[model samples]
Target chain A: MSSLKTPSTFIEGPTRLGKAELAALVAADIPDGAFVNLGIGQPTLVSNYLAPDSGVTLHTENGMLGMGPEAHGDDVDPDLINAGKIPVTELPGASYFHHADSFAMMRGGHLDICVLGAYQVSARGDLANWHTGEPGAIPAVGGAMDLAIGAKDTFVMMTLQTREGQSKLVEACTYPLTGVGCVSRIYTDVAVFLIDRDGDHGGGGDGSVVVRETHGVTFEELEGLVPVPLRRP
Target chain B: MVTITQSALDAVADIPDGATVLIGGFGPAGQPVELIEALVETGTRDLTVVNNNAGNGDVGLAALIGAGRVRKVICSFPRQHDSHQFDAKYRAGEIELELVPQGNLAERIRAAGAGIGAFFTPTGYGTPLAEGKEVREIDGRHYVLELPIRADYALVKAHRADGVGNLTYRKTARNFGPIMAAAATTTIVQVHEVVPTGAMDPEVVVTPGIYVDRVVVVPTAATPRPEEDQ
Candidate 1:
């Protein structure tokens, strides 16, 4: 249980991490040599920090593996792109498949990890990322639902709070769920959430959410923000 | 051997009104813009179309949607920064949308082509996307029953094709071409070039000739990179 605790030397202050710093934090946590999918938006920034030779294979749901960094100048190939539709380069040993086989890699548990951007994550690790379930909003579910449910582990990278200062971590996701109990860890600007799936992480021997790390705020402040029952690490 | 034509319009001239069409591409990477433009010229209407995105900008799929041809769209991601045509029509209640999870959409299309009646998948289980679907628990995990999504025609794009229609794609542009080719009753491909029957290396053929019905040489200008269009 002690290993689950936030290190005593962790920096906690009013100065928060910039988006790049947060991305680097998430990038540092990904296991070396793992096959990972980085979702569009903020999660895509995590790719910049990953070394090309880290043995980390990037999977784009549009049908590619071993995706390299963003293409520049003459290296840009419209045919070679990431899930975001931006032109990119292919690393050595890159392979391509059709949409079906690409999704199969995720759904069949062939992918090691997938990083997604979330609107809300529940105490039970429920994910709500695809749609806002709004009246006027156009719903686009891209590969979020698949990435959330299919990958071996799902990690969410987002800001800790809404612009209105509301916590993203809640007791239950009000938005339509992308997957049920699929999130394993969440890396945010303010904290790293370790979700205990059916008492797997010793989160007080229950499937509770634990705060493994915190920055820009105190543990008490973080607890006051989230609506879920939290086990302070 | 497949019928090879030099005209994009001639290639898609037989796609009648009110047909179910599967348009290949992930965004615009592999979208057969020439074939879609020809479909517009045919003045087709009341179509049920399936693709990854709804449309982007005022061209290709967007142009067809703007021309009031599509009655329904079954796709995973329909809303994007440049999806004005789909957004305007959808908000005005002029179109029907069935939003499937990406994985479910792909597998359903694959199942339709592979002759599978239905299969259980864990992709959208326990989410709102699984509404009215049957869920089964196998080995302590839940999966929902998903049906196939077959189509009357498929419009695809590939880098090159042999005389008999063996296809080879370029990079990620190969996204949905092969699967859509198999999932449709008639598959029409628009390629930049048509080579001799034995020209293309057999080992590199992404989509076999059996799944393809027709091929057209669009004579694209040396694979020029288009503007930054997502």
Candidate 2:
């Protein structure tokens, strides 16, 4: 055995937080007794990082509440799955309902927080996660639209920039909007930011974006990459 | 006397061409595979299917779409990782698609069951999904007017059913089954077991007999299929 030695390589560029670290950062901010819904992709990892004793209840849009972390190996129950179609275990006091009833809980503003992955988030908090507006792109809207507008706080968990280094946090989203001014905070690999209405009652009171936290990148460095002016409050 | 059919083929024989059908399941847990296979065997054409996702692999709705029986699909998530059939058909312009938000899709079906003409929902408020739809502002929040969606037929799978069609589903497998049963003009269910009318506890029944129009007993997996030997 080669002992699976860790490789030491030097690359000169801005370091970004890994997926697990990003998830842990988002999970730390969730308060106890909060009703939360985790979106399908990278945001689903947030559930795994929640404090073991925390009373946070996870809601799946496919008619389940109090969902636990992803089930593994022999523990996987095919019937008990999450919105992502992965087998999951039910937490204590778990309850199941109809699909419409689950969405009612979502659209009824019963969720305290919802973390989602986005293609782009505008400075005014407009979310565009479903379709990229590219021709021939399969548009699968899923539960994103409902969760974006329904949750009390919608926190986006994604990389700060695209693989091509295009900033996802922009002045205005070029993609089709999922919800207007609905995003509360964004958790990217490089930094975390809280979105607010730009200016003093401009653009329906949806205005500038501000930085709240940074990982390896400085606030100024992150702001330099974004399309919009970043306010440091 | 419950309307129980011995043949899955006979249960779906009455479904005509160009029918809007509601299929129950999240992925494959509660899909009426036998009924779908029977419908495929019957060669019903130009079907408009309504479901959560398109289908999995080469079974269930995907098989039907692969056979070119589906003319259109109205669903929330139609393109899954393994949904190559739908992707191929959709890209080829062989089948039409009406993408709906998941919550909106479920609520539209539920609204049909509840006899609601239309209702305003905040799901697709400011997105492209809200385009060409009526928008209203109540309490300074915008909501889009969504109409009820009814189907000509509903094919659902249940864990068990009473003789009179009272249904109780297993765990998370119960998704969209009860609502689809109520939202269609003719609802047909495939179940593993059928008990006596009063055998099931009243509190456990998810779908009442009144909503269900037909019931069929599905063969258990332990029993071998005749085709398997061939």
Candidate 3:
């Protein structure tokens, strides 16, 4: 249980960790041959950190499967890209499919794990990724809904709190819910916490495991990476 | 119509006060900066805006909130960015806000495009979203009623287009532009380049020409940037 107390759970950091540290941390959870969806931003970094020898296969919503991590500078492939339009590398078995079929894979629950970026996440496991309520904003939802529902396990990759000093993990999201009770776990800049699946906030009553701080650092040190000091509800 | 170098007022001259406009983009990406810039200069007020995420501050759709022109906002997540005016107006109840789950909003607009009256989904079952909305159980699972979404004007961005208006979007920035194009009465597109007819591959055309009404070329504009991509 003490080893679980890793300091930062984010993909990027000022800590400038070695690539092996990053890959080892992520690869520990990724089972062999797990089908995973990598979200656009920081979540995408996980692909690069996935251990090379692991059997993890990455699926991109934009229609690539068996994707490998980012290529070294000499090996960058210009034509192959991820949903973020960033040039990436593909594993030997990488396959391309029609966009429709790709979406079907997402909506039909074929994905085993999906790491997402969120604006807010409730303690009840609701996700709010789309829209933030200002005027002249772009009005649309990307493929987030399909992944939230279709993935066998939904994990959120975000700071535990918002830049405005608000906790993303809440009793209930004030914003609209992306998926009701779909979140399985949360990885933040500070620590890793699993949702209390059992209905009890204390971790044992319902089936939900209580999330404890993994790293030995101060909550402020964790918050500094995420840019928000989280207060649990 | 007189052409001025970046004529601010002339751009939005046709958009009347109190008109409901749907702007395209997922987050801050693919927003019609030209139209928004023009809307700001034209001093139009009392507009109902629909979009994904509001622009942060002094950018994107959030700029309208900063200008205090939006009367109402129909969106999903409106509290992500820190906009003083958005927070102030929302707290004071100065603006009417209707929040729909992200998927529901997309499907509603897609339904509008297909001319389907409404489609049922299980997104908001047994929750606040199911409140007030009609619900029906299908095979033991709950479903919620979602109405189609249509806007008076749709503003979009594209990487390339033809004279007749087939569109191609830069990757990532191609979030809501094509969908909003189908859900609006009049669709205006801002493009980086307009190529000769038949230049763009038919297979690559994202939005067909039938949905586009007007084209506004952004001269010397680089590719549209998706805020989340970088």
Residue by residue across B1-230, what tens digits does model 1's lDDT show? 58998888888898999999999888878888888989999999999999999987788998999999999999999998888999999999999999998888989999999999999999988888899999999999999999999999999999999988999999899999999999999999989899888988899999999999999888862332433433
Model 2: residues >4 Å from true position, as ranges?
A1-15, A197-206, B221-230
For candidate 2 chain A, the 10 contiguous residues with the lowest summed lDDT are A1-10
Cα lDDT, model 1, residue A150:
83
Which pairs of residues clash in candidate 1, taking residues 3 or more apart in a chain or in different chains?
A: none
Report lDDT per candidate. Answer: 0.87, 0.84, 0.66
Candidate order by decreasing lDDT = 1, 2, 3
Model 3 residue A161 lDDT score:
60
* Native-to-model Cα distance after best TM-score fit, residue A218 in candidate 1, in Å: 1.8
Q: Write the per-residue lDDT of candidate 2 for residues B2-100, one digit (tens) a residue.
A: 589778899999999999999998877677888888899999999999998887878888899999999999999887877889999999999999999
lDDT of 1: 0.87
Candidate 2 matches the true fold with a TM-score of 0.92
DockQ head-to-head 2 vs 3, winner: 2
Which docking category, incorrect, acceptable, medium or high, applies to candidate 3? incorrect
TM-score of each predicted structure versus truth:
0.95, 0.92, 0.66
DockQ of 2: 0.44
* Candidate 2, residue A199: how far the Cα is off, in Å: 9.5
Report DockQ per prediction, comma-separated.
0.66, 0.44, 0.07
